[model samples]
Target: MPTAHEVFNTRFVKAMNERNYDEYEALLTDDYVGEYPQSGEVIRGAKNARAIVEHYPGGLPQDNIDTRSTRIAATDARWVRTPTFTFVRAEGTGNVGVSAVRARYPDGSAWWVVNFYELRDGRLARSTTFFAPAFEAPDWRKPFVEQREAPAER
Candidate 1:
């Protein structure tokens, strides 16, 4: 059996990837809350699950197949393809995890996401997640700092 953290992470990824709505909903707590900072939206309880199921083009009904992004989890800088997520646990027995997700969209676009989860009784009680895009450093800073190879190149 996987650890609670492992179970929570995989179940989340699998449920969503498979579009198993009921199974996905079962992973969350009754009073679950989800915050989407980028969209300035907050969904509470079942609404959160509903929103996840309803929103995201990834979940739209299409050919019966796993169309979600291909995920690659890593602790170091290099990105390695894998289904298992890497999450840090918070202090205490309560299940709290901070995950760093790197996924490639169906169209090949990619993003890095951070999700903060708080669990109650082995179910997700609250979570805040945000997707991050890579941006070029400002030209103004080039003069102020010495030029060096970017992390991606190393």
Candidate 2:
């Protein structure tokens, strides 16, 4: 039997890969909140989170939408039919789980997505995700650094 945290982590990734909004919503608490620190955006409630995934590339429209609680900061987002997760690793203790994921988009772009998940009563209560694009090493540091092979694409 898997631990609660392990189960949550597995389900979370599955939901993301399948874009199963209903399953994802079921895993979150009613008042769950998610934040993207890079963009200073907040997603309040599971519904809003679903909206974000559903309206990818453009995010939630600014027209006739409620921004009193949640803010949309993803102006330019990429939508991929299939996202490959490579160098995947996750660890959890008790109610908190941290996942470091390398995702490859169909556009030949790779990004690091680190997620911190907090569980309350076996359900996700809060999540904070940070994203950073992969970049080539600067040539200026070539003399001081040793080259290493890039992570394998999945």
Clashes of each: 0, 0
lDDT winner among the candidates? 2
lDDT of each: 0.63, 0.71
In angstroms, the error of model 2 at 60 is: 17
Consecutive 10-residue window with the lowest summed lDDT within model 1:
82-91
| Cα distance off (Å), candidate 1, residue 136 | 7.1
lDDT tens readout by residue for model 2, 1-154: 7666656677777776555679978888989999999999999998888777766653333355443333233223542344545436777888888888787664557888999989999788998999888777899999999978866332
Stretches of candidate 2 off by over 4 Å are 1-6, 58-87, 152-154
TM-score of each: 0.63, 0.72
